[model samples]
Target: MNTLSSIDYIIFVLYFVLVASYGYYVFKKKKAQEHDSKAFFLAEGSLTWWAIGASLIASNISAEQFIGMSGEGFFVGTAVAAYEWIAAIALIIIAVWFMPVYLKNRIFTMPQFLKTRYNDSVALIMAIFWLFLYILVNLTSILYLGATAITGLVGDATAGTPEFQNILHLIMIGLAVFALIITLGGMKVIGYTDVIQVAVLIIGGLATTYLALTIVGDKLGVGNSAIAGFKALMNDSPEHFKMILPRPAATTGTINTPLNLDIQKWVVLPGIAMYFAGQWIVNLNYWGCNQYITQRALGADLKTARTGLIFAGMLKLMMPVIVMLPGIAAFVLHKHNALPGFSGSKDGAYSAILSFLPSGLKGLSIAALTAAIVASLAGKLNSISTIFTLDIFSKYIAKEKADEKKLVITGRYTVLVASILAILFTWNDLLGIGSEGGFTFIQKYTGFISPGVFAMFLLGMFWKRTTGTAAIVGVVLGFVLAIFFNNYAVGIFGKETWLYTAYTYETLGKDGLAHATTEIPFLINMGWSFVITVATMIGISLAGPKINPKAFMTDKALLKLDNRTIAMIVITLILLSALYVKFW
Candidate 1:
């Protein structure tokens, strides 16, 4: 049954009512602070540590993770979990080190940090850059991917048909409206309501994962057991269980011939090489530096923020089980010829597995996915509103310091406009997201800026000697270097340079014809770009004052970690270590 049953609708309706009523309750409670810009945008001191933690995971795991990461799980297996697991370590670094810098400096936004540490030019450039990236890349992808995934669950509308497109548009609009309802209420509503969202998504996601595994077990002639199903998956798809993919050997095959799939997987993950390359940059930049992510903790005290981040890190440990396992299960089922009529698109793996779900449980899984998508949509819209209203509008458009009420109103308006723009771009798939694959599309585009942004933040924080001129040059150079390394480096440096090897693979283009694409793995590209950018910035800064006059000063007291923080850090490390030991 591809369509929802009456029971499914009832459960979904109850979920909708529960989230709406709770959001209303939160909005009413925080009504007094509604006019305050900081209160509206960041929730100020209102969000509890758990709320912050929940909201962090809620915002971070969207359709991108559910649909995209699971799809990757189907294609490449456990290696994709590196994004989530490494994020645990990244959150630890941010909590202990980066949080001290930001909280001690009273930094509320990424642009504000740049302005305070570097200069107005660097901040303004990045503010605009972030706005475009969020709206065009992040927001649109979330909306498109989320809507497409939900539409699959809704009914069997044939892909590429008029009805399918119509259903997709309706879901996109519905998601935008749903996010708007929560976002307009401000961050307090988003943060508190996210607790409910996280609960729903977890229960629902786990149910889906369990059912998927049981289906695999039953298909394998084992009892209908999740444990048995999981064992079957590992036994059947042993290649998918590896933490590090083996590097592809040089092989001769044409686009017409069957090329090695390892080359294709390497193009996405890049094996152990990724650990040394863009993997750290990707996680660090996303967990520590991105506005959509970091905003949840920015308003809290040092201890509260750090604790919340660590708590979120612990939650990150189990995320792959909820998000990635089903795709691996689906791969096992597909391998055993259990998934009839499967279209073979890796992105479809999660939804395909969902079809195995029982009625009420199916509703729960849909709600879970809806929770992830809505939470992320609300979070991204809020961040977009925060940047445009506070960083751009308040700083530039306002002749004088805008009143709190005016700024708050500006934020609401920004959210509305940004949501509209996202829907519009996603409507036609203007960015060719479907062709590139959602997870790869986001990672590749975002990678272009990560190297530069991470370098700027890393050096700006630790190296007081990093000059404003160097910061400005570094951002631009990093982006240019990233583009060069991704597209032109293999051409210019030759395919087998000492620096890196470009892998050739044939993938279907938009016209449905296989095209030979050769490129250096993007993560490797990012690592080289970051190295060159940092070296250039260091060289440029060396010509200036030893200590930049505007550099942020840090104190030892500000960096102190409490016992709870240390304990959580230890627990996180232990869990992460065990996971790698099992999977590696």
Candidate 2:
């Protein structure tokens, strides 16, 4: 069942050729302006509203969403959809408010924003942090998880087998090379080709989802119908359909004998607490502040940027259906003992669901997965290259008016170097992405920096009294508090506190024995960290000036919303409200 038919190979090959050919067409059309840094990195003004919108979604959805989020779906159910759902609202805010500021200020990169608002020191420090985070956490996980997912479809593979590991390496390298081809063509190529990539991603993903639901229905003795399969899932695994997880109950059992699986679930997603805490930070910082995402709209005029962002938000509404529902279906089937030889790893849920796909359709699904992985890889590599070439190299190494050709060449080299490093790190699973669950692993590590980065950006933009010193200190303090809350707070202050309660859960250790670990939920940690960091920053800034000398001039005109923008915003809100009302 894992093996692909000849028709499947033909479908996949055709897809590869179509994308490559289109990417080449885009590259050649823009070849004359490719040397311009803005054109190469941001695609400048070439991208239309639709291209920008599709590119935004393409860059954002990768192996992490397809595999990691689906894995989360298998384990935690609809609650995991919060990440995608909240992102819709976040994009709205960015379109209306954040996009105006960015476009008016002509900010091209995140570090550049820091340098303009605060000081050179703050900018330089963050540039380094972002570089490491992108390569180590974001890039590595995408490669490792994507390779793992595709390898599952290629053969009857078992985890930890020699054959499986060998296939994984080949897929990782192949993915890296494919991404490099797109990335070297620069941002125009990335943006335009992403239109096709997003199309394949959605179509193939929906095809897989439909089949998964039908399989579920057929397995439950109903006819092969997606609606029937969905009903069967809801009927069979009622607990998985909840939007919020309950708080962990007090545990009295030993580590191995009596497992608190509910507590483990709560640890990953801590109910209303997360809604009040890291949820906003995660969405806002990602959609508004991150270079990899915001770069899509940075090159456009104000109206175009706003429209593109709203378009992306609309697309986000359907993402959970494409990415998360299959895992839930897999859970229903696995619970019924319908999936033979399944390993029961949460990350394997997507692959197990793919077994239901017909021969030609199997190739289409793999193409979808490959599209997600390659688009994200190319996007991340471009961002890494942008930061290094523009933020670091332009300022430090060149220290003069650099030539456009040299800058473009430097950016390409950075992409190659970053891809190699990511592949090397992911080769051995050195980051333990598999153990932590891919979705949770990304959120946890990224949480360490989000509190600080979001705090800095928020205070810098709105609060003119916020000084450079406050910005620097806030960044450090946010990180420190996040670490304290995550690692040491429970041990120092006992499990129960007025602020938050730490929960104890047993997880299987490397020795194949359960071990009890106690910790405050990470989202709660991020929330408290943000609150305290903002307070400290405010106090420090109060001593500076009522309005800092470098404060950006603003006018009512900048925040004004057009009729079209307003219409889109209203539609997005209506859809978003209905979703939460039903799920909540």
Candidate 3:
């Protein structure tokens, strides 16, 4: 590992101090108030659209999306931008249809909605599932990745050792500290800090993107070299860069072409399909329905809440340019080589960032990376604490009529506990066990829970006949399907044989093809999971008796036509399609 220059160390120190000071300032402000748990957890129902909007973006675009999604874009192409585009549409839907329901009912959490729409048992089940999912899937894994990335950038001088063990410890500690600060003031604090953090994150992300383009352009010997390199890389590795790469045939060592020429065929396609189908559902449930996230919105008046969602959606559209483009640039700049002083040859986007960065800019870039990761961790920690306090503690564990001050205290303690647990879990080194693969284990696990959650929420919202029993059943079935599709049927059987064959045929003709096949497990998992989940939900709904539709219909929650929501959704979709056609 390289030594950190004095400047880098100074920058790091300054960042830490600034973040901590912000936390302290928020704490002081909240402490002066006649505190109640509701105020702490819900920001005293006071937040503007801008604060909520920034916080929402900051919370959602964590290390996972920055590192993992960007890496995928580097290895593949712009096709991975689906996450952002899909989310844009999803947010609009939430603003139009879902926001009214949440605001009208004055619900505090996503599960709280389930409780009202379904029953307490159903709500409890969803709450428990979400809590576990947030801890295991979102918080822990993000901390692990963020820490790993930051430690890598800081090198051995600050981290003490270049070994994975040392790195993981540093990450967990950093995440825990940030979590503590976020918990100090609850949603209001999170909102205020998020405004600052989001600024840091964007400036940092854009800085890296600019530095990357500059360095890569210099190396390739052309002003437009970054763009040229991208085109060249695409030409050389057409298969890797293509959005519609072919899938492996069912029989070993065969290649199967889809009947539809226009359909995308990359390994990411299935996941992308699932994302398009499921992500909007989850996003609406999140931005519009989920309380910890939406508490910021609910705190706002209806106008501000609407404005925030719209503003956040606009921000979401810009993410691909910042996060995805750099990854693509990385692959173009550092093909088939280790970054300077690294032990092994680097692969994909992360390697690109390391190799292409210059000396002074490297420090600033690293700080930006750290900021993005911290922003993500802080947002999740705050949200998780909010859910625990409102959905579980206030309802089940402690029914005491606590004032805002006492409630804030309780919330701070919960944040501390949640942060500790997240750090501990992240420190366990699950990613190390699966480090051999190009993709991280965290991404694989995310594929399982996210898709399932998305499916359940979509069915529940749109289908009035959908029962609590059906929703619960859908969750179970969706989860099982995710596992099977990700692990067994698609993962083990899909890509290995054909990939080996293609490589072998290129090297030594048909004779070597038999042994060269490699599996594309993610594609298979995603494809089957989608098929099965949709099938199961539809079949069950049909087989089961229909509940009265009137029970699910709440006129107050539905937007009036004057709102322009329907027109916005249509126009957004059309514009996105045009962009996809023009760019990808």
Candidate 4:
């Protein structure tokens, strides 16, 4: 505790007070209009492009990304930034092809689209799965990680108490604050606060980056020293920094040597292959279909919506610079011995960030980190409440044609309840119970629901033959496959195979098998989830009865077009090419 200067404490307290005050202001300004399902979940379709764009960025980029993904970039290199670049393409596609349908239908929730396109049963199932996953996986795990990081950064102030007890207390406090904000106002509050959050996140990220560069530059004593140092770090440890590291075979007890021919191959191409082939299918279902996220765009007019989507896409282009570059810089500046507990071989970019913080800057940096975490918490809290209130409670328990005011009140209550559950779940420390590094639990749990939910909505949208029965089967199968692949197949089966053993031995030596493992098993599980879901849906649709195509598509909906779609596609392709050149 003595190591933490008073400056750090003051900065933290100031940040907390400012955020709390802002939340209160947002709550106070919320319109008192009838808060029906539409207003509660979708902000009564009143957002403009700027608010929509900022909210999207704030919601998407959070502590999980800054700490976890940046840690990945530090360990693996810029190749990890592929997720952002790839998403640029996905977002464009959604803007051009997907948004029109959603907007035209005036759908509030993605599940509602399912109900209309498939059947009520499909919608209900999806709603249940999404709600459960939100509480158990997304909301809880993120809160845990954010809370843990804050505790670590703040040190001892919240320590000495029982570990789990302190974490639970912190999470509950955070969640309660978040719930209060959302309850007072719905998407309007979220959007307004997001603009502020996004601004803070960018400024803070850039400040960190600039400080790191200056420190590195001064150490090496050259203008190009920072770049040289970065290159040296990568060059000196080829295996660690290389975009494509070796992997064990699935069956042969051999190395998959040929797969590493091209650097792009190692980066995210295989994952991208799964993505376009499968992952995008799910992401579209997320951005285009998911209510909580999409509600921002849905609030905009058509042109504003299109602009918002494009603006978000453009902002994503800067993500690697903010998240990945800092990690790389941290690794370069600090070297292997930079931070305690991360000295053996793997780069400790995240640890380095903490280690390298100077006195005054430390407080500001911690404040920024706190802001990122709180922003994520706020978005998830609002969205989870939105989905629960709109899709589940309104449909099943409360059938009244509630006015907007009543709906807003219900939304507030829902956020409170969800926040409580999330706080309780966070207290359990399920996030840290696993063997994988920090935040692995989040990725694993998300895999279970994300793939399946994605599958259900995608098929519901495109395939007229997809019946309620087929949807249920696809959703269930997707979930089962995602779990099996994520847990049993990758964790157990993948490790024991002769191929894995051989590859591990060859690439990493006799002990290679011990070190050579993926954190996410992304390639295997993601691929399996998609293939199984698509096959089951198609096979079942063919074997069983066919559904009316008219229900899924209409003349006006099918033929609609806007120039924004073309622009998005072009921009995405150009950006993808640029990423390949820079990282590969």
CA lDDT, candidate 3, residue 23: 67
Q: Please give, for residues 440-481, the per-residue lDDT of candidate 2 as tens digits.
A: 889999999999899999888888889999999999899999
Model 3, 171-258: lDDT tens digits are 6696668666665666777787777778877886777777666655555655544465455545544544443345433343332223
Quote the positional error of residue 386 for candidate 1 in Å. 0.7
Residue-level lDDT tens digits of model 1 in 339-405: 8878889989998898778889989999999999999999999999999898999999999999999
TM-score, each model?
A: 0.98, 0.98, 0.82, 0.83
Better of 1 and 3 by TM-score: 1
Ranked candidates (lDDT, high to low): 1, 2, 4, 3
Candidate 2 worst ten-residue window by lDDT = 250-259
Distance (Å) between predicted and true CA of 136, model 4? 1.0
Give the whole-model CA lDDT for all candidates, comma-separated: 0.91, 0.91, 0.62, 0.63
Taking all chains together, the TM-score of candidate 4 against the true structure is: 0.83
lDDT of 4 by residue, 280-378 (tens): 644565577666568788766677787788788888888877777777666655464444544422223553566466776777766666666666666
Better of 2 and 3 by lDDT: 2
lDDT of 1 at 76: 95
